[model samples]
Target: MKLTPLDAPGYEKVVYAEDAESGLKSIIAVHSTKLGPAAGGCRMFNYPDLETAKIDALRLSKGMTYKNAAASLPLGGGKSVIMADPNTDKSPELMQAFGRFVESFGGMYTTAEDVGISVEDIEEAAKFTSHAAGLNKGAFASGDPSPVTARGVFLSCLAALKHAFGRDQIEGKTVALQGLGHVGMYFAEHLHAAGAQLLVSDIDAHAVAEARQRFSARSVAPDDIYDVEADIFAPCAMGAILNADTIKRLKVKLVCGAANNQLADDAAGDALMERGIVYAPDYVVNGGGIISVSTEILKITDEKWVDRKIEQLAETTDKILTKAKALNASPHKVADQFVEEVLAN
Candidate 1:
């Protein structure tokens, strides 16, 4: 195993790790510890290059910081990303090596599941260190956070509807949702239960087919999702999907989902505001997962506490939306301000 520390302004620490025997190459970024020890997910992806991976770690870590703050959890923000593809390069050895790297953080960072990462992999990592959360087995184990995250985003959609459309329910509304991963699928269940029509798309045809069968969702080509006219556009896929080009093509009145760093840049948020689309900050809207995982990290075994926090998170979203409307600013900007206020005191 080899570790190389890197410089990252505004971040507490950044390091790249590689294991020759297991072919495990990854980067971990700790963006802040002002609130408490950092915690986030470990994701595996076949990034184009090391630079791309570093940027992702940095952005994702910072996003986690805001996410924790938004959820009012004591944990700070941090994240790790693996360079190898989950389908082809994943192995128990590689996951164990990654666990060793996480152990080197000395409890300053705790981890859970993320894209291309499974509960089994985190369980394997748990064999190496106690810094992993979201485990499937254990007295305080908080399983996969997808359902909680989806629930938060679903609540956020209702909040945005009340703020923007003057209604609190989604019944009979059309939701154009991108990506049908675990979180997306769970969110679709909430929408289906609420009687919201789903217009869904995903790179995974099988997942799309499942949503179609389950919710009678209309399947749209992945690229054409932006053109679907709907009341809400939920991006439960990769980051930066709401960039300049796609933002212009969006016909939805509200945008919310479980994807982190949904905005390509601050300009994208500004653009969405200009276009009259109510933009819910991804970190704030999708924070229910961390709220659940934090319990295991903090050893808080109260499920009712988590339920209360999830409900309060919706209230926070309502306040941010209301504040943004009063200020005529983007909700992301308002959310950043709220996080800064949290960090300041």
Candidate 2:
């Protein structure tokens, strides 16, 4: 594999690891350690190129930093990405080797499941290292965090509705969803239960069919989601979909979802602001997964704290939106300031 020089200035540590024995090749990026030990998820994907995977790792790790800080969790940001398709490359040997690599960080970076990784996969990885989360056994096991993450995004969606449309509800509103993955599917349930009509799209036709059948959702082509006339545009897919071209096609008033690094760059967020769309920062809305994993790390079995933290996402959304309104600035800018303020002190 060709190696690219790490050029991320804001990151605390960037490491590339390879294990020929298990056929493992990965990159781990720790973006910050000011608040506490670095913690994030490990993603596996068949990236087209190594540089794309590296950029994804760097962007995701940085997003996790802001995510943990905004959620007020005493943990920093880190992420690892394995450049292989889980469909073909998943194996005990490969997982254990990755776990050992995580252990090399000596608890400075703890990893959980993300993307192609699963609860069982992380539990397998845990056999080689205590720095793994999302396990299925033990008192701290949290399992898959997709439902909780969707719940948080749901809460943030309502908050965005309240801020943008002056209603503290989703009833009768149309929400266009850009993905039908775990988070997106569950989020669709929340919106459906809240009486919000759904327009859903996904690369997987089966997932789209399931959602459409379950929620009476209207199915649209994956690319046509952006053109759907709706109250909110929820992008639950991968990051950077909200770049210059897509933003120009948006027909919604509120933009919120469970996808991390939703903005192609900071300017994409500013573009939404300039278009008069109420944009919920992706990191703020998608912090539920981290919040759930934190419960395992902190050994807190209390359900109340989890509920409170999820509910606080709405409060945080209101605060950021209000500040943006007051300053007449982009909500993303305001959110960055909020994260910086929390991390600074």
Give one clash count per candidate, in the order shown. Answer: 0, 0
Q: TM-scores for all candidates? A: 0.99, 0.96
lDDT for each residue of candidate 2 in 1-345, tens digit (9 for 90 to 100): 223346679788888877888888898999998999999999998988878989999999999999999999999999999988898989988898889888888899999988889888888789889998877788878889889999999998888888889987799999999888878998999999999999999988999999989999999999999998999999998889999999999999999999889999888988998999999988998999999999888788787888899999878998999889999999999999999999878
The sequence of per-residue lDDT tens digits that candidate 1 reaches over residues 1-345 is: 899998899999999999999999999999999999999999899999999999999999999999999899998999999999888999999999999999999998898899999889999989898999999998899999889989988888888898768888799999999999889999999999999999999989999999999999999999999998898999999898888999999998899888999999999999999999998889998999898888899999666988888888888999999999999989999999999999999
Candidate 1 deviant stretches above 4 angstroms: none
lDDT of 1: 0.92
- What is residue 145's positional error in candidate 2, in angstroms? 0.9
Give all candidate RMSDs, comma-separated: 0.8, 1.8
